[model samples]
Target: MSDLAISVRGLTKVFGGRRVVDGFDMDVPKGAIYGFLGPNGSGKTTTIRMMCGLLTPEAGDGTCLGFDILRQSQEIKGRVGYMTQRFSLYEDLTIRENLDFIGRMYRMKDRGARVDRALVDLGLAERAGQLAGSLSGGWKQRLSLAACMLHEPELLMLDEPTAGVDPKARRDFWDEIRRLSARGVTVLVSTHYMDEAVQCDFIAYIAYGRKLISGTPKDIPRLVGLQTWVVEAGEVGTLEAALKADPDVAQVARFGAMLHVSGTDEARLEAVRQRHPGQWQKLDGGLEEAFIWLMSGAQDNFAGPAARGGA
Candidate 1:
């Protein structure tokens, strides 16, 4: 078997004469947890669909799980599990019933045994008889994951699986993902949450269907070449406007009480700081700062007046 679980290159997809994803490429090794990070409407979903063979790319060449993506889509589908952004299961059914139904769909040899194992594996054995509709957001997410894994797929594609889930629940979900990876299951997950992105083995940042950067989280900051500083003071709003007006401040965002200011040119950023001495304090620029700077530098493909609702 190939070391790569997914390999695609020159992938392009267009809708309404506008490129939603353009010349995309990615390589994911087996058992690796790859994070796909981007703003909403940045083509992250489109790219994932193409990689998983759910939607054909307008132009691309690739393989998923060693199957030709263009010709062996069916084979790829069977070996991969996809969890959509929304809750897609029958809420009226009990948790156990849902797993049983999925097992039957896969035509597993022992559907009952598979369901029993799934219940235990996801910590849902005690609540097996409870209606899925009655479960909390976190519990519902767990049920969705259980359904996806019932067939024991080699790769899992999760799209914002933890959105709206509590902090503890999100942490637990990631723990489960890591545990699965240890057992040699490859995962490709898309998320806007920075905390979640930090958990992945590698991360790819995409915008308007174009891949901007892909590497470990630590490497991405260096690749973007951003110099960031945190500013905290009494008149933060005033300082923010002043910083935004400066040519050197490429990006400025408020995180609680402090404003994070960043720029690609370190020398220019320092010049701006010197000009506004004592107005802002300098501090280390973290991953969030780098991401903001990177995103600010990207041209939004959906920026036109007509693309407002479409994006």
Candidate 2:
């Protein structure tokens, strides 16, 4: 418990009589880059809010940064920096103004020096006078991060922080996140990009308000128990149709000119591979394949009783 930055159990939240986050549990280690992953509308946001003291859980109990999530939420909030899915900063204000405003909101001491340092640290000093509204997606993201770090909080909860940023900008954002983790600041970020997810030290996959799996990036696919083979040929489309017809191939996914066929039974998958005339290479399933397989089997809680029954 001492080494954990966040620990929660049976965390539940309901909206319109439907459980958005149902009996969720999690343990995020201190100074670790933990990836919070899930399909859209899977309640990842609600869970993050509950863990960081932004939203109260109707059920469950836990602590964040040594403060009780329920009883000491204010204490927890003081130590956590939360960035929402959407940019929440004042767009009309300049980068420096936004950081200064955030500092004032926290009533931070030495606001000028702190804002100046944040500007330099995030490479925003040259553009300090630029209005946030005029900045690109990448620049706005950098400003948001700079604002979040003004108080030097011990924990950061970023919800889809790199969604619209370019490839280089995304890479730069992750580099900073790594630096913060190295300095003992725990970071929990949600992302849809597989490349970004692989950068995390730990990952948790969720769907339909339920946590399906959590582990180190290297172990997630193995833990899901999938055996996969990559098949490539000139007639990939034709091969894909034939592979899908085989009952043994539980999952068939097209990756450019190749198809990833996966299943729990290695022997069955091998049989399907032998039946197809292509360049079949047996390999361990990747995170994308594991997630696709996981999501395909998940039941949508919002569906009607008949739909759920059919599913």
Candidate 3:
């Protein structure tokens, strides 16, 4: 078997004459937790759908789980488990009922055993009889994950699975994701949360239907070539204004009481630091800074009078 679980090139998708996803390329290795990130309408979801064979690409060729994405969608779908941004399980059904139904759809030989195991594994055994509709957002998320894993698919594709959930619940969900990854199940997840993005083994940032950057978390900031200085002062708003006016500072973001000032030119940034008063600590920029820097250069496809809700 190939080391890569998914490989695609020149993937494109159009809606209303706008290229929602344009000439995309991606490679997801087996057992990797890949983070797919982009701004709203940047085609993150569209690209994922095409990769999983749920949506056909206008122009592209790829293999998912060694199955031809265009010619063997059914084969690809069978080996992949998909969880959408929204909770999609039958709300009227009990937790156990939902799992059983999914197992039936997959025609699993150990349907009953799998449902029981899923409920137990996801900490839903006690609430097995509870209606899915009555569960909280976190519980519903847990149920969705449980349902997705019911078929024991080789790959798990989750779209913002932690969105709107409590912090603790989000942490718990990621713990489960890591456990699955440790068990050699490849995971492809989309999330806007930087905390979650940091946990990914690989990351790809897309914008305006094009890829801005992709690499390990540590390498992303370096690749963007941003030099950042953390500014600690009694009045950050005033300093923020000052930095924004300076031509050298490319980006200034307020983080709590401090400000993170960054720019592409290291010498210019250092010069700005010497001019500023208060505490200034120079350090490497992180994922958040790189994300903002990459996003600033992208042109939104929906901007102007020709806007469409394509994404």
Candidate 4:
């Protein structure tokens, strides 16, 4: 029994002459909420699939839940729950019926009791008789999560599970995830939302099929060595454009009336600030600022696979 739920090295996947998931390595501790963050087409989903045994990696050696990912895929599958990005249950069936069917598929004994317990645990007991297709986005998400947990797998992998749901629904989903984690279920969740990323025990930021950074959200900013300043003033649009045009300003983004200006070069950033002293106010760097700077420094995999390296 290893402490790591997932341990892999040199995992690679190529498609149509493009290295969708380049040589990647990961070590996820047991019962931890590991958030996988990246932009679109950054290979987040592909990497998750390989790790969970849904897709075989072109090159890699690892174990998932103490089972060999390559040689014991079927055994691994039985002990892992995978929630896809979209709702994948039988929408035409009632919530209870859908859950019962899943229990039967897994061939679990006491199917009725298991279904009942799952509904109660996921707060779907009230909606048990409702057709899944008629439920709102939030309810649908809850039902999907319940179905995934019916088998009670030790490891859970969720890919963008909160995508189109409302804010309240997203918050509810995260609450359930945290509860599961507390009960000793390891979770690997892929998300683009920074708010959700903060909730994870640790995060791995991937870009162009390679992981650029991995650490606690608080440690990521410090690791990147970024200096940021928040600018507040009238006519923020003018200030944002001015900062974006300057090479000294690595990144500039507007948040309501305030603009966030950041750069890796401390001296150059100071020079920019000196020139626009009256137009902007300076403040400390934030997680979002650090993430933007990290992304800017990463090389896009447009040319080909990333050369083997470490950050």
User: Number of the top candidate by TM-score?
Assistant: 3
lDDT of 2 by residue, 1-311 (tens): 99999999999987766778888999999999999888888889999999888888999999899899998988887789999899999999988889999999888989999999888887779999998899899988988888888889999999999998999999999998999999999999999998988899999998777788999988988998887788889988898899899999888999999899888887887778778878888765388888888777665443554224221
lDDT of each: 0.85, 0.87, 0.88, 0.85
Runs of candidate 1 with Cα error greater than 4 angstroms are 278-285, 300-310
Candidate 1 lDDT, 73-101, residue by residue in tens = 88888889999999988889988888888
lDDT, model 4 = 0.85
Q: What is the C-alpha RMSD of each candidate to the true structure, in Å?
A: 2.4, 2.2, 1.9, 3.3
lDDT of 3 by residue, 147-251 (tens): 988888999999889989999999999999999999999999999999999999999998878777899988899988887888999978898899999999999
Model 4: how far is 41 from its true place, Å?
A: 1.4
* Ranking of predictions according to lDDT: 3, 2, 1, 4
Better-scoring candidate (lDDT), 2 or 3: 3
lDDT of 4 by residue, 115-180 (tens): 999888877788899888998988888888888898998999999999999999999999999999
Write down the worst ten-residue block by lDDT for model 2.
Answer: 302-311
| TM-score of candidate 2 versus the correct structure, residues matched by position | 0.95
- Clash totals in order: 0, 0, 0, 0
lDDT of 1 at 212: 88
